[model samples]
Target: MPRQSAGILLYRKTNNELEVLLVHPGGPFFVKKDLGSWTIPKGEYDDSEEALAAAQREFEEEIGSPVTGTFLPLGTIRQKGGKVIQAWAVEGDLDADAIVSNTFELAWPPKSGKVETYPEVDKAVWFSVAEAKTRINEKQAELIDRLVALVV
Candidate 1:
């Protein structure tokens, strides 16, 4: 079976428009990437773990902020390469400027024999659904479309 990840889609309505929260991957890999590189705050877990709880935990860990509001199930989606992602939508707003991210230890520079820590997510921003579609990976963008279709 493919790896599974659980995540939350933070959304809010402001000025008669809906905006969604998206995060940028940290470390050296994504430093220069732009559109289609952003993602929902998510993390992988084993079958024994619960999706909802994992989602909340990843949200807190990646954004370094507390989550609020009720989660509405948005169902699961499989990427073209076969990673299954489950997500829930919540109606809430948060600041993009004050983001803080948690770090993880990894062998930086690949096989350097030196371990280094990098932030799992460098930063987060709130974007309109229109802008999010362009920023998020094409496969993952489907989640935004589905969530919007179900809610709007």
Candidate 2:
């Protein structure tokens, strides 16, 4: 079965520009990751859980702060990796520094007995849609386009 994830795409209008919030993945694996590495604040969920609630939970977990707003469903999209992600566009913005991501443990090097903890999302930032296209993953860029269409 394909993996399923859900998240909210947050956008805010600043200085006449629409900015979208995107997160950078954490850990050594993503150390040099930049383009195509940024992603929505999202995570996988099981069939036993509700999609919207899971989105809210994952958003909170990844970004570290609570977010509440009217969710405008952007529908589901299958990423290049075949992960089906459900997203909603909400009309609120958060300070990137407010993010308090949860941690995960992973062996830094394969076969190394040492383990290290890393934030699931190292940091988040707001970028203009034009700039966001460059920061967001290739497949996930569709959300930014769709969301712009919705709000504009």
Candidates in order, TM-scores: namely 0.93, 0.97
lDDT for every model? 0.89, 0.91
Tens-digit lDDT string for candidate 1 (1-152): 89899999999888888899999999888999989899999989887889998999899999988787888888998887799999999998788878888998888789898888899998898999999999997888988998899777
- Model 1 lDDT, full chain set: 0.89
Worst 10 residues of 2 by lDDT: 89-98
Cα error, residue 37 of model 2, in Å, equals 0.5
Q: Which segments of model 2 are wrong by more than 4 Å?
A: none
Q: Count clashes in each candidate, considering only residues at least 3 apart in sequence or on different chains.
A: 0, 0
Model 2 lDDT per residue over 20-116, tens place: 9999999999999899899988889999999989999999999877779899999888998899999988888778987899999998787898999
Model 1: lDDT of residue 60: 92
Looking at model 2, the pairs that clash are none
lDDT of 2 at 64: 77
Task: Give the root-mean-square deviation of each candidate in angstroms.
Answer: 1.3, 0.9
lDDT at 117, model 1: 87
lDDT of 2: 0.91
